[model samples]
Target: MTSLETLLRNTQDVKVIDRSIDYNEYIPLDLSAFNPELSKFDIKCAVSFEEFIEKHLTLNDAKVAFGGYNEQRNLYQRSTVFKDEKTEERNIHIGLDLWIKARTPVLSALDGKVHSFNFNAGFGDYGPTIILEHQLENQIFYTLYGHLSLDSLKDLEIGTVFKKGEQFATLGNAAVNGDYSPHLHFQIIKNIAEKFGDYPGVCSKKELPFYLENCPDPNLLLKITA
Candidate 1:
Protein backbone atom coordinates (compact mmCIF):
# COMPACT_ATOMS: atom_id res chain seq x y z
CA MET A 1 0.00 0.00 0.00
CA THR A 2 1.20 3.54 -0.85
CA SER A 3 1.03 6.38 1.59
CA LEU A 4 -0.93 9.51 0.68
CA GLU A 5 2.21 11.64 0.86
CA THR A 6 4.10 9.26 -1.36
CA LEU A 7 1.27 9.11 -3.89
CA LEU A 8 1.04 12.89 -4.09
CA ARG A 9 4.78 13.26 -4.33
CA ASN A 10 4.86 10.84 -7.23
CA THR A 11 1.97 12.34 -9.16
CA GLN A 12 2.83 14.59 -12.10
CA ASP A 13 1.27 17.07 -14.54
CA VAL A 14 -1.42 18.06 -12.03
CA LYS A 15 -2.39 21.73 -12.13
CA VAL A 16 -5.27 23.53 -10.44
CA ILE A 17 -4.99 26.78 -12.34
CA ASP A 18 -5.51 27.57 -15.98
CA ARG A 19 -3.34 25.25 -18.07
CA SER A 20 -1.76 28.18 -19.94
CA ILE A 21 0.34 29.17 -16.92
CA ASP A 22 3.59 27.37 -17.62
CA TYR A 23 6.37 26.90 -15.12
CA ASN A 24 8.04 30.12 -16.21
CA GLU A 25 4.87 32.10 -15.45
CA TYR A 26 4.46 31.04 -11.83
CA ILE A 27 6.18 32.31 -8.65
CA PRO A 28 5.88 31.94 -4.91
CA LEU A 29 4.42 34.78 -2.88
CA ASP A 30 5.51 35.36 0.68
CA LEU A 31 2.70 37.03 2.64
CA SER A 32 4.48 36.92 5.98
CA ALA A 33 5.48 40.53 5.37
CA PHE A 34 1.83 41.38 5.82
CA ASN A 35 1.89 39.97 9.34
CA PRO A 36 2.26 42.88 11.74
CA GLU A 37 4.29 40.62 14.02
CA LEU A 38 6.65 39.88 11.14
CA SER A 39 6.97 43.01 9.00
CA LYS A 40 5.44 46.42 8.29
CA PHE A 41 3.09 45.78 5.39
CA ASP A 42 0.21 47.97 6.39
CA ILE A 43 -3.05 46.77 4.83
CA LYS A 44 -4.45 50.31 5.22
CA CYS A 45 -1.81 51.60 2.84
CA ALA A 46 -3.11 49.48 -0.02
CA VAL A 47 -6.04 51.08 -1.80
CA SER A 48 -7.73 47.75 -2.50
CA PHE A 49 -7.19 44.03 -2.95
CA GLU A 50 -6.68 44.45 -6.68
CA GLU A 51 -3.98 47.00 -6.06
CA PHE A 52 -2.28 44.73 -3.61
CA ILE A 53 -2.23 41.88 -6.13
CA GLU A 54 -1.09 44.16 -8.95
CA LYS A 55 1.89 45.23 -6.90
CA HIS A 56 2.69 41.61 -6.17
CA LEU A 57 2.42 40.50 -9.80
CA THR A 58 4.57 43.41 -10.92
CA LEU A 59 7.25 42.78 -8.31
CA ASN A 60 7.42 39.05 -9.01
CA ASP A 61 7.32 39.46 -12.79
CA ALA A 62 5.09 36.40 -12.94
CA LYS A 63 1.62 35.73 -14.30
CA VAL A 64 0.46 33.91 -11.17
CA ALA A 65 1.30 34.07 -7.45
CA PHE A 66 1.21 30.89 -5.35
CA GLY A 67 1.90 29.97 -1.72
CA GLY A 68 0.65 30.50 1.91
CA TYR A 69 0.81 27.00 3.38
CA ASN A 70 1.66 27.56 7.06
CA GLU A 71 2.30 31.21 6.25
CA GLN A 72 1.45 33.84 8.86
CA ARG A 73 -0.55 36.60 7.24
CA ASN A 74 -1.98 39.87 8.57
CA LEU A 75 -4.79 40.11 6.01
CA TYR A 76 -7.10 38.14 8.31
CA GLN A 77 -7.19 41.05 10.75
CA ARG A 78 -10.00 42.63 8.78
CA SER A 79 -12.39 39.72 9.40
CA THR A 80 -13.95 38.51 12.65
CA VAL A 81 -13.95 34.90 11.49
CA PHE A 82 -10.30 34.54 12.51
CA LYS A 83 -10.56 36.55 15.73
CA ASP A 84 -13.66 35.03 17.29
CA GLU A 85 -13.42 34.62 21.09
CA LYS A 86 -13.50 30.82 21.09
CA THR A 87 -10.21 30.41 19.26
CA GLU A 88 -6.95 32.27 19.12
CA GLU A 89 -6.46 34.85 16.36
CA ARG A 90 -6.22 32.69 13.23
CA ASN A 91 -3.65 34.36 10.99
CA ILE A 92 -1.76 31.45 9.52
CA HIS A 93 -2.84 30.39 6.03
CA ILE A 94 -2.80 26.61 5.69
CA GLY A 95 -3.62 26.43 1.98
CA LEU A 96 -1.95 27.40 -1.26
CA ASP A 97 -3.46 30.51 -2.89
CA LEU A 98 -3.21 30.80 -6.67
CA TRP A 99 -3.44 34.53 -7.30
CA ILE A 100 -4.61 35.16 -10.82
CA LYS A 101 -7.34 36.82 -12.88
CA ALA A 102 -11.01 36.21 -12.27
CA ARG A 103 -12.86 33.62 -14.36
CA THR A 104 -9.77 31.49 -14.77
CA PRO A 105 -10.78 27.87 -14.99
CA VAL A 106 -10.14 25.77 -11.87
CA LEU A 107 -9.35 22.07 -12.30
CA SER A 108 -9.46 19.11 -10.02
CA ALA A 109 -6.09 17.64 -9.05
CA LEU A 110 -7.42 14.09 -8.98
CA ASP A 111 -10.43 11.97 -9.90
CA GLY A 112 -13.05 12.60 -7.25
CA LYS A 113 -16.71 13.03 -6.49
CA VAL A 114 -18.28 16.22 -5.16
CA HIS A 115 -18.63 15.57 -1.47
CA SER A 116 -20.29 18.90 -0.72
CA PHE A 117 -20.41 22.55 -1.79
CA ASN A 118 -22.09 25.86 -0.90
CA PHE A 119 -21.85 29.62 -1.03
CA ASN A 120 -20.05 30.87 2.06
CA ALA A 121 -20.76 34.61 1.98
CA GLY A 122 -19.03 37.23 4.11
CA PHE A 123 -16.46 40.01 3.97
CA GLY A 124 -13.60 37.49 3.80
CA ASP A 125 -15.41 34.26 3.13
CA TYR A 126 -14.78 31.59 0.48
CA GLY A 127 -17.84 32.65 -1.52
CA PRO A 128 -18.66 29.64 -3.75
CA THR A 129 -16.74 26.66 -2.39
CA ILE A 130 -16.44 22.99 -3.32
CA ILE A 131 -15.00 19.94 -1.66
CA LEU A 132 -14.22 16.68 -3.39
CA GLU A 133 -13.58 13.25 -1.95
CA HIS A 134 -10.70 11.33 -3.53
CA GLN A 135 -9.02 8.00 -3.01
CA LEU A 136 -5.40 7.27 -3.89
CA GLU A 137 -4.61 3.58 -3.48
CA ASN A 138 -5.88 2.83 0.02
CA GLN A 139 -5.79 6.41 1.31
CA ILE A 140 -8.95 8.50 1.31
CA PHE A 141 -8.68 12.27 1.49
CA TYR A 142 -10.36 15.46 0.35
CA THR A 143 -9.55 18.58 -1.62
CA LEU A 144 -11.08 22.03 -1.20
CA TYR A 145 -11.41 24.84 -3.74
CA GLY A 146 -12.43 28.24 -2.39
CA HIS A 147 -13.11 31.82 -3.49
CA LEU A 148 -14.97 30.78 -6.59
CA SER A 149 -17.48 32.60 -8.79
CA LEU A 150 -21.13 32.18 -7.90
CA ASP A 151 -21.75 30.72 -11.34
CA SER A 152 -19.47 27.83 -10.50
CA LEU A 153 -22.11 26.49 -8.14
CA LYS A 154 -24.83 26.38 -10.74
CA ASP A 155 -26.44 22.93 -11.17
CA LEU A 156 -23.82 21.22 -9.03
CA GLU A 157 -24.92 18.19 -7.08
CA ILE A 158 -23.38 15.94 -4.46
CA GLY A 159 -21.71 12.80 -5.87
CA THR A 160 -20.97 14.45 -9.19
CA VAL A 161 -17.75 12.86 -10.37
CA PHE A 162 -14.81 14.59 -12.03
CA LYS A 163 -11.70 13.24 -13.63
CA LYS A 164 -8.25 14.50 -12.92
CA GLY A 165 -7.58 17.88 -14.54
CA GLU A 166 -11.29 18.40 -15.20
CA GLN A 167 -12.55 21.96 -14.93
CA PHE A 168 -15.02 22.27 -12.10
CA ALA A 169 -15.01 25.93 -11.14
CA THR A 170 -13.74 29.41 -12.00
CA LEU A 171 -11.94 31.96 -9.90
CA GLY A 172 -14.17 34.81 -8.70
CA ASN A 173 -13.46 38.52 -8.58
CA ALA A 174 -13.02 40.57 -5.44
CA ALA A 175 -16.64 41.68 -5.54
CA VAL A 176 -17.97 38.16 -5.01
CA ASN A 177 -14.97 36.19 -3.74
CA GLY A 178 -14.91 37.45 -0.21
CA ASP A 179 -14.02 40.96 -1.43
CA TYR A 180 -10.45 40.07 -2.27
CA SER A 181 -8.38 39.76 -5.39
CA PRO A 182 -9.20 36.81 -7.63
CA HIS A 183 -7.44 33.66 -6.40
CA LEU A 184 -8.09 29.99 -5.79
CA HIS A 185 -7.62 28.91 -2.20
CA PHE A 186 -6.64 25.22 -2.52
CA GLN A 187 -6.38 22.92 0.46
CA ILE A 188 -6.02 19.20 1.24
CA ILE A 189 -7.82 17.71 4.23
CA LYS A 190 -7.16 14.30 5.71
CA ASN A 191 -10.17 14.28 7.99
CA ILE A 192 -13.15 16.58 7.48
CA ALA A 193 -15.13 15.20 10.46
CA GLU A 194 -18.73 16.46 10.31
CA LYS A 195 -18.11 19.69 8.39
CA PHE A 196 -20.21 20.01 5.31
CA GLY A 197 -19.13 22.26 2.40
CA ASP A 198 -16.68 24.11 4.68
CA TYR A 199 -13.57 23.56 6.74
CA PRO A 200 -11.18 25.84 8.60
CA GLY A 201 -8.65 27.16 6.10
CA VAL A 202 -7.00 29.42 8.66
CA CYS A 203 -5.73 28.63 12.15
CA SER A 204 -4.03 30.36 15.06
CA LYS A 205 -0.58 29.81 16.56
CA LYS A 206 -2.04 27.64 19.31
CA GLU A 207 -3.93 25.33 16.94
CA LEU A 208 -1.14 25.18 14.37
CA PRO A 209 0.17 21.80 15.49
CA PHE A 210 -3.12 19.99 14.95
CA TYR A 211 -3.93 21.66 11.65
CA LEU A 212 -0.41 21.10 10.38
CA GLU A 213 -0.88 17.42 11.01
CA ASN A 214 -4.33 17.09 9.44
CA CYS A 215 -3.72 19.37 6.46
CA PRO A 216 -0.58 18.57 4.53
CA ASP A 217 1.06 21.23 2.42
CA PRO A 218 -0.87 21.33 -0.84
CA ASN A 219 2.41 21.72 -2.66
CA LEU A 220 2.92 18.04 -1.96
CA LEU A 221 0.22 17.40 -4.53
CA LEU A 222 0.69 20.48 -6.72
CA LYS A 223 4.43 19.78 -7.14
CA ILE A 224 4.76 23.43 -8.14
CA THR A 225 8.30 24.64 -7.85
CA ALA A 226 8.97 28.26 -6.91
Candidate 2:
Protein backbone atom coordinates (compact mmCIF):
# COMPACT_ATOMS: atom_id res chain seq x y z
CA MET A 1 0.00 0.00 0.00
CA THR A 2 1.17 3.50 -0.79
CA SER A 3 1.90 5.65 2.25
CA LEU A 4 -0.01 8.90 2.76
CA GLU A 5 3.16 10.92 2.28
CA THR A 6 4.00 9.13 -0.96
CA LEU A 7 0.46 9.49 -2.20
CA LEU A 8 0.59 13.25 -1.62
CA ARG A 9 3.96 13.46 -3.29
CA ASN A 10 2.59 11.65 -6.33
CA THR A 11 -0.33 14.01 -6.86
CA GLN A 12 0.28 15.90 -10.07
CA ASP A 13 -1.05 19.00 -11.90
CA VAL A 14 -2.73 20.89 -9.08
CA LYS A 15 -2.58 24.32 -7.51
CA VAL A 16 -4.25 26.26 -4.68
CA ILE A 17 -3.80 29.66 -6.27
CA ASP A 18 -4.37 30.97 -9.76
CA ARG A 19 -3.31 28.39 -12.37
CA SER A 20 -1.77 31.09 -14.53
CA ILE A 21 0.80 31.98 -11.89
CA ASP A 22 4.08 30.19 -12.57
CA TYR A 23 6.54 28.91 -10.01
CA ASN A 24 8.80 31.84 -10.77
CA GLU A 25 6.03 34.19 -9.77
CA TYR A 26 6.03 32.72 -6.26
CA ILE A 27 8.55 34.43 -3.93
CA PRO A 28 9.95 32.60 -0.91
CA LEU A 29 9.43 34.87 2.10
CA ASP A 30 11.31 34.28 5.36
CA LEU A 31 9.32 36.08 8.05
CA SER A 32 11.22 34.25 10.77
CA ALA A 33 14.44 35.75 12.09
CA PHE A 34 15.26 32.45 13.84
CA ASN A 35 18.32 31.87 11.67
CA PRO A 36 21.03 34.33 12.55
CA GLU A 37 22.70 33.65 9.21
CA LEU A 38 19.67 34.83 7.25
CA SER A 39 19.11 38.53 6.65
CA LYS A 40 16.24 40.04 8.60
CA PHE A 41 13.84 42.93 8.11
CA ASP A 42 11.49 44.88 10.40
CA ILE A 43 7.99 44.16 9.17
CA LYS A 44 6.39 45.80 12.19
CA CYS A 45 7.19 49.25 10.83
CA ALA A 46 4.72 48.79 8.01
CA VAL A 47 1.50 50.76 8.63
CA SER A 48 -0.55 47.68 7.96
CA PHE A 49 -0.16 44.06 6.96
CA GLU A 50 -1.26 44.99 3.45
CA GLU A 51 1.60 47.48 3.17
CA PHE A 52 4.07 44.94 4.56
CA ILE A 53 3.14 42.30 1.99
CA GLU A 54 3.09 44.77 -0.89
CA LYS A 55 6.53 46.06 0.08
CA HIS A 56 7.96 42.53 0.12
CA LEU A 57 6.31 41.68 -3.19
CA THR A 58 7.81 44.81 -4.74
CA LEU A 59 11.25 44.12 -3.29
CA ASN A 60 11.25 40.53 -4.52
CA ASP A 61 9.52 41.56 -7.79
CA ALA A 62 7.00 38.74 -7.41
CA LYS A 63 3.23 38.59 -7.12
CA VAL A 64 3.09 36.01 -4.36
CA ALA A 65 5.05 35.66 -1.09
CA PHE A 66 5.14 32.00 -0.06
CA GLY A 67 6.73 30.20 2.88
CA GLY A 68 6.48 29.40 6.62
CA TYR A 69 6.50 25.64 6.98
CA ASN A 70 8.07 24.64 10.31
CA GLU A 71 9.66 28.07 10.45
CA GLN A 72 10.19 29.82 13.80
CA ARG A 73 8.84 33.34 13.41
CA ASN A 74 8.59 36.52 15.43
CA LEU A 75 5.34 37.46 13.63
CA TYR A 76 3.25 35.98 16.43
CA GLN A 77 4.31 38.62 18.96
CA ARG A 78 1.23 40.73 18.39
CA SER A 79 -1.23 38.07 19.48
CA THR A 80 -1.85 36.50 22.84
CA VAL A 81 -3.16 33.37 21.12
CA PHE A 82 0.43 32.25 20.71
CA LYS A 83 1.60 33.57 24.07
CA ASP A 84 -0.21 33.33 27.39
CA GLU A 85 0.78 32.74 30.96
CA LYS A 86 -0.34 29.11 30.89
CA THR A 87 1.60 27.86 27.90
CA GLU A 88 4.97 28.45 26.32
CA GLU A 89 5.20 30.78 23.30
CA ARG A 90 3.99 29.16 20.10
CA ASN A 91 6.42 30.65 17.63
CA ILE A 92 6.91 27.80 15.16
CA HIS A 93 4.72 27.96 12.08
CA ILE A 94 3.66 24.57 10.72
CA GLY A 95 1.55 25.74 7.77
CA LEU A 96 2.34 27.19 4.37
CA ASP A 97 1.46 30.90 4.09
CA LEU A 98 0.75 32.35 0.65
CA TRP A 99 0.81 36.13 0.97
CA ILE A 100 -1.07 38.01 -1.69
CA LYS A 101 -3.72 40.66 -2.27
CA ALA A 102 -7.10 40.51 -0.61
CA ARG A 103 -9.89 38.84 -2.64
CA THR A 104 -7.39 36.69 -4.51
CA PRO A 105 -9.03 33.46 -5.48
CA VAL A 106 -8.20 30.44 -3.30
CA LEU A 107 -8.65 27.03 -4.89
CA SER A 108 -9.08 23.61 -3.39
CA ALA A 109 -5.95 21.45 -3.35
CA LEU A 110 -8.04 18.37 -4.03
CA ASP A 111 -11.56 17.09 -4.44
CA GLY A 112 -13.13 17.25 -1.01
CA LYS A 113 -16.23 18.03 1.00
CA VAL A 114 -16.44 20.85 3.48
CA HIS A 115 -16.15 19.21 6.88
CA SER A 116 -16.46 22.34 9.00
CA PHE A 117 -15.98 26.09 9.01
CA ASN A 118 -16.22 29.10 11.33
CA PHE A 119 -15.28 32.74 11.78
CA ASN A 120 -12.32 32.52 14.14
CA ALA A 121 -12.17 36.26 14.62
CA GLY A 122 -9.31 37.61 16.73
CA PHE A 123 -6.15 39.67 16.50
CA GLY A 124 -4.03 36.71 15.38
CA ASP A 125 -6.67 34.12 14.57
CA TYR A 126 -7.57 32.34 11.35
CA GLY A 127 -10.64 34.55 10.82
CA PRO A 128 -12.94 32.96 8.26
CA THR A 129 -11.61 29.40 8.06
CA ILE A 130 -12.66 26.22 6.32
CA ILE A 131 -11.67 22.60 6.73
CA LEU A 132 -12.26 20.08 3.98
CA GLU A 133 -12.39 16.32 4.43
CA HIS A 134 -10.89 14.03 1.83
CA GLN A 135 -10.29 10.30 1.37
CA LEU A 136 -7.45 9.10 -0.81
CA GLU A 137 -6.88 5.41 -1.38
CA ASN A 138 -7.67 3.88 2.02
CA GLN A 139 -6.57 6.85 4.09
CA ILE A 140 -8.48 9.86 5.34
CA PHE A 141 -7.19 13.35 5.82
CA TYR A 142 -8.14 17.03 5.89
CA THR A 143 -7.03 20.34 4.42
CA LEU A 144 -7.55 23.71 6.09
CA TYR A 145 -7.83 27.07 4.34
CA GLY A 146 -7.38 29.90 6.83
CA HIS A 147 -7.43 33.70 6.69
CA LEU A 148 -10.23 33.68 4.17
CA SER A 149 -12.64 36.47 3.37
CA LEU A 150 -15.90 36.50 5.29
CA ASP A 151 -17.74 36.44 1.97
CA SER A 152 -16.24 33.01 1.26
CA LEU A 153 -18.06 31.52 4.22
CA LYS A 154 -21.36 33.27 3.57
CA ASP A 155 -22.82 30.53 1.41
CA LEU A 156 -20.81 27.47 2.30
CA GLU A 157 -22.40 24.46 4.00
CA ILE A 158 -20.82 21.61 5.92
CA GLY A 159 -21.16 19.03 3.13
CA THR A 160 -20.52 21.31 0.19
CA VAL A 161 -18.23 19.56 -2.27
CA PHE A 162 -15.43 21.24 -4.17
CA LYS A 163 -13.57 19.81 -7.12
CA LYS A 164 -9.82 19.89 -7.35
CA GLY A 165 -8.67 23.35 -8.41
CA GLU A 166 -12.12 24.74 -7.77
CA GLN A 167 -12.02 28.29 -6.43
CA PHE A 168 -13.96 28.23 -3.21
CA ALA A 169 -12.54 31.08 -1.12
CA THR A 170 -10.83 34.42 -1.46
CA LEU A 171 -8.07 35.88 0.69
CA GLY A 172 -9.13 38.19 3.53
CA ASN A 173 -7.74 41.53 4.56
CA ALA A 174 -5.78 42.26 7.75
CA ALA A 175 -8.84 43.59 9.58
CA VAL A 176 -10.50 40.19 9.40
CA ASN A 177 -7.55 37.87 8.78
CA GLY A 178 -5.93 37.97 12.19
CA ASP A 179 -4.64 41.54 11.77
CA TYR A 180 -1.86 40.28 9.54
CA SER A 181 -1.11 40.35 5.86
CA PRO A 182 -3.65 38.90 3.48
CA HIS A 183 -2.52 35.30 3.03
CA LEU A 184 -3.89 31.84 2.72
CA HIS A 185 -2.70 29.68 5.60
CA PHE A 186 -2.91 26.16 4.20
CA GLN A 187 -2.34 23.07 6.33
CA ILE A 188 -2.83 19.32 5.94
CA ILE A 189 -3.90 17.08 8.79
CA LYS A 190 -3.83 13.30 9.10
CA ASN A 191 -6.29 13.43 12.00
CA ILE A 192 -8.10 16.59 13.06
CA ALA A 193 -9.55 15.05 16.23
CA GLU A 194 -12.47 17.14 17.55
CA LYS A 195 -11.41 20.54 16.28
CA PHE A 196 -13.97 22.23 14.15
CA GLY A 197 -13.07 25.35 12.16
CA ASP A 198 -9.81 25.86 14.06
CA TYR A 199 -6.55 23.98 14.56
CA PRO A 200 -3.11 24.89 15.81
CA GLY A 201 -1.27 26.22 12.76
CA VAL A 202 1.53 27.29 15.07
CA CYS A 203 2.96 25.29 18.00
CA SER A 204 5.34 25.70 20.91
CA LYS A 205 8.70 23.93 21.12
CA LYS A 206 7.35 21.17 23.36
CA GLU A 207 4.31 20.53 21.06
CA LEU A 208 6.30 20.63 17.83
CA PRO A 209 6.88 16.90 17.57
CA PHE A 210 3.23 15.93 17.81
CA TYR A 211 2.04 18.64 15.40
CA LEU A 212 4.81 17.82 12.94
CA GLU A 213 3.57 14.24 12.87
CA ASN A 214 -0.12 15.05 12.51
CA CYS A 215 0.28 17.94 10.06
CA PRO A 216 2.74 17.07 7.35
CA ASP A 217 4.35 19.66 5.09
CA PRO A 218 1.75 21.05 2.70
CA ASN A 219 4.38 21.50 0.02
CA LEU A 220 4.41 17.70 -0.31
CA LEU A 221 1.17 18.11 -2.23
CA LEU A 222 1.58 21.66 -3.58
CA LYS A 223 5.00 21.05 -5.12
CA ILE A 224 5.57 24.80 -5.01
CA THR A 225 9.26 25.35 -5.57
CA ALA A 226 11.02 27.82 -3.29
Highest TM-score against the true fold, candidate: 2
* Distance from true location, Cα of 70 in model 2, Å: 0.4
**How many pairs of residues in model 1 come into backbone collision?**
0
Candidate 1: where are CA atoms >4 Å away? Answer: 33-47
Question: Tens digit of lDDT per residue, candidate 2, span 47-72?
Answer: 45566677778988899999999999
Q: Which residue pairs of candidate 2 clash?
A: none
Off by over 4 Å in 2: 35-48
What TM-score does model 1 achieve against the real structure?
A: 0.92
What lDDT score is found at residue 160 in candidate 1?
Answer: 99
